[model samples]
Target chain A: MASMTMIPADCSSSTAATTRLLPMSCHKGKALHFSRWVSLSNRLTASSFPSLSFKARASSPLISAKIVIENAAKVIDGKEVAKQIRKEIAVEISRMKDAIGVVPGLAVILVGDRKDSATYVCNKKKACEAVGINSFEVHVPENSTEQELLDSISKFNEDPSVHGILVQLPLPSHMNEEKILNAVGIEKDVDGFHPLNIGRLAMRGREPLFVPCTPKGCIELLHRYGIEIKGKRAVVIGRSNIVGMPAALLLQREDATVTIVHSRTKNPEDIIKQADIVISAVGQANMVRGSWLKPGAVVIDVGINPVEDAESPRGYRLIGDVCYEEAIEVASAVTPVPGGVGPMTIAMLLSNTLSSAKRVHNFR
Target chain B: MASMTMIPADCSSSTAATTRLLPMSCHKGKALHFSRWVSLSNRLTASSFPSLSFKARASSPLISAKIVIENAAKVIDGKEVAKQIRKEIAVEISRMKDAIGVVPGLAVILVGDRKDSATYVCNKKKACEAVGINSFEVHVPENSTEQELLDSISKFNEDPSVHGILVQLPLPSHMNEEKILNAVGIEKDVDGFHPLNIGRLAMRGREPLFVPCTPKGCIELLHRYGIEIKGKRAVVIGRSNIVGMPAALLLQREDATVTIVHSRTKNPEDIIKQADIVISAVGQANMVRGSWLKPGAVVIDVGINPVEDAESPRGYRLIGDVCYEEAIEVASAVTPVPGGVGPMTIAMLLSNTLSSAKRVHNFR
Candidate 1:
């Protein structure tokens, strides 16, 4: 017999539950509503045990517990949090400018005409402007050589006004990503993609000049939400150099006992269920189900995957690695896909730029 | 009623069971005998569940199963493995020299008069000689300035003959260890302690010029013994920069799902039981016991700790982080302390030096 149990509605059990649940009328609340609406309409036909979709749910009693929704997860308002961070960064930039007569500057180099990359660059520039930081933009043609890209990076490396340098990723398949990323000066590497910065992040008692923006944003969200990381069991799914890897390092640095589950990891659901915190960045939509979560676990979904959505004007809509409806019922708090990590990345870039400028000018 | 289960004596169950168990009369057998003698006389009074020493064993049914030992774990003879590795390295060195007229050179800088450091340096020098490699030794006074040490490192860094430069650890407390270590050029950092090298090691698709000796030795043992790593669940019992961290990274690179259990971890025994491979590097003697292990798990005990031993010549004897007597009864294969990881470290150092020289000379 398949046994079913009710998921407790209690949120007070989680340390992260201290975060105030956002009102349904707010921007974050709208994200939750939209996520659920899409999930209910499109994915309702799938099994409730999405994490166990590969296995027969009846065989694994552990993941067979039926989720009875009474209270939804506290929607972590990354949009609201990013806004607050930007305001704080703006204040710091103004204070530094007033004291040292210098403003923080961010330089972004975009290669090719990929629509998504262009959109990301535009958002970052707007974010810098709103935060009172100088923004420099460069566009290289798709056919440009790797040396040309390196040349642009070299110019920005020497620019005294450029406190941060970012080269938008997926630079034409012909370009060597490693060589180009290495060309940015460590001091000016606001993206924190340098191997040196990553090494420092992994080592104990060593500090990276700048942490990668997306992972930094993820940690910042945990901090602002008062999610306890110390002595907790953290599971980071995926091992990409940018997000999953750095996020695990950051969590480990914060004293969390971390396990990394990658593509080769067998029975990932078993590992995920052991975590007090789950950060999924595998870029697979709805991979993590409620059955994979430990009760009261705080989830930070870094994957922004697109799934077919015939109801929408566009044929596809963005979703996260976690199943929104399922995770909300099981997790104590969850980050929504669109408004969560997306906004935080730009905010952290601004923060890094401000910090770089402060360090250069010797400002407190 | 307490239930007792007989532990299966089948060595064929574990993938790592392919390693032939050493004869009881060999050097590794002496290690087993000595470990058992000490354990029987001194630690026999303690509970069989040493991993649950802090907990009441009867309270946890999972760990309460009585052990009916029918088979001992396959004793991994690291001394034998290291000897084989040395021969391989010697052959490579000879071939490289014959091919390119270049002999690999390793420079060791010892600052303080620490007895252990001196012993280690002496062992390294002898190992290099045995492998037909040039050895350079520099001894600086305890009262020497940091600048003097840095100057010596600078000379070795620029020396065309020097393939590897190693600064003995625990330099005079007054000198900055980080500053001294960073002085060694990355190319000559056979120790693999440089941040850039570690960063490269951690990132996917990026290769480090060298891997830290001890961790590299651990992996090499598994490879030589034909222990499977891919898709296995590996738990590393420590987070030290040199051994535990790099060991975990190496395991992950080999496609193992790795979790690092540190001092901050809660319920480490629970985590340990889930692992197919256990690498304990924590310096606590006899910390991991029978109850913490999975029946077919392979154990690599990296800790070489000295506990009080009035019965021995030095008034103390060395043991590993794992309780050998208990682990042997429970695990499929286990590496003994003194004869295990100790010899492998120096062999790996020799291998790294040879490789560095090969890279410098463009020798295959």
Candidate 2:
């Protein structure tokens, strides 16, 4: 295993610090040598990495090579893992269809003209088709009443063909999100936003009918990678109901001692440094730095934050809550921003749909 | 303020370590000095207290004076607090009754003839009568069917006079606890064991109809004492559904950075040392020692474990999960075992009943 060594190089500019990596050994028949210019303002205190010192080497203008050995973190390819899951789901669906003459169905209800929501819904429909699951769609105008949306959910609840029902979020501000989400029958709540489902998830000895997709996807990645969770220290950044809170609960359920760091938390970096596993879902671009991680810690980044990018066609590029460049050198394993937890959300939704159908039909 | 100083004294016996306290300045015109014999086996490492060294002083047989200054933690008298709360609740109930001509009523169903359960039920009834709230009781044999219990719950659910219904736990092995708990109306779930209530408690911006009594009491003690919770580090030392789990959720809801330490947690003392507040619900007697706490931490001990005491009329006496003798010298404030969380549980139950009546009748 070839390791990368980071050496702090004296920089002429005071605002920026440069770190140079000298060629050491070959990995995959390729020599590595590079220099990185990091802004001093964004540099987190190196308290977590006590062995490595990045203090200014302004006294020595020449090569002041300080060997800071770093191991390249194994990249958790969510796209590939999600594809594997989809294939497994397809096999189950085909088998169930042959035995019971039934296929899982997912219903998507969209009430607004938002472009992003439309794109997400479209992708979900295509994913369903690829996995041999039937897809149902209903689009209502933004001016539609809450009663109309509730009626749609009620109709879907009565329809046995639709195993799962998901209403696109960020509904019209006038609509009561809780009321509308609660209206979805718990059995068909694939999105799993209902209070009853969440309650079950929080209670010990009780199982939720459906786990929320994003957090469930995060845990699935850990399991698929064969990471041990029991008796390990895990820290979850952000406490949003959708991702962070449920993710912490899931980790605790798996017997990992869990701590939740939120906006109100003080010295979060110190807490993050102690975790054997870290899951960040704060939706902040590159908020977690390499210095905040414990060496060999597994990191699951659920954030998909967009940063302004002049080179991109859309003038913006997506990044995770973790600084990828720094994390690759420190963590034992990490999930990439766009291709990591993002793809797994939809995949888990489909899995929930399939499970719901099987449960309803008493299929193994 | 008078401070206590602990000095390690050489003991003749190798198995036991003795700590002697020299007389310091008077507090309330009373001089305090004492010697305590602590078992070496139960001694936790003094890593949290770097300043204090408890290493064996076997070399010196006489008094080797090493003054370790310790602040005496204020004793939180739960019986007094509960009494004050009962008075406040009584005033509210009288005002509501005069304004709307309606009184709150609590109905309790006891399934078995367990002596402890009988005492608890009788105490609850007397508490309700003392506060001018109507109390209803149902006693059933151990051989009673689950349907019979469900029928009692159903009757209480439809009764306008009954604002809250409680089913004593540890029902006969034949009964399903979850089903019976779920049967209680959400609005009247004064015990707050219903998953829906717990789910609401876990979620942000959503309030449960009633918070679980014991955990609610713990938070109340903090609030009543004017202890700040926001942005503070809090540690909960268990994850039982009844107390520890709900306590952690409640602490998080109040914006305290929360960490849960369970049996699977490694080096629990290290984690507990970082908390500004600690709540321990594990039933093991004296599991948390002074060395496990950070100086000035506020501790709430919820365990009521019975230990042998030959001097008492009863062969056993109750103690808390924390080592009270050690905690009183280290913590800023602490709740005693019997006089602390025990009284607050019943008080919160009564409070929940009153709140239910006010909510159902639309009486502010």
lDDT of 2: 0.80
- Clashing residue pairs for model 2: none
| Candidate 2 lDDT over residue span A1-364, tens digit each | 0111221111212223334333324211111111011111122222322222234222253433332333355567677678778988999999999999999999999988988889889999999999999999999789999999999999999999999999998798999998898899999999987878878888998989999999999998888766788999999999988889889999999999999999999999999999989999887667788778887788999977766667779776777878765665567777877778888999999999999999999999
- Superposition error at A18 for model 1 (Å): 28
First chain TM-score for all predictions: 0.83, 0.84
Question: What is candidate 1's CA lDDT for residue A138?
Answer: 99
Clashing residue pairs, candidate 1? none
Instruction: State the C-alpha lDDT per candidate.
Output: 0.80, 0.80
* Candidate 1 lDDT score relative to the true structure: 0.80
**Model 1 per-residue lDDT tens digits across residues A253-362:** 99999999999999999999999889999877777877789877889999887666676696667778787666765677789888888889889999999889888888
**Alpha-carbon deviation at B218 in model 2, angstroms:** 0.1
The candidate scoring highest on lDDT is 1
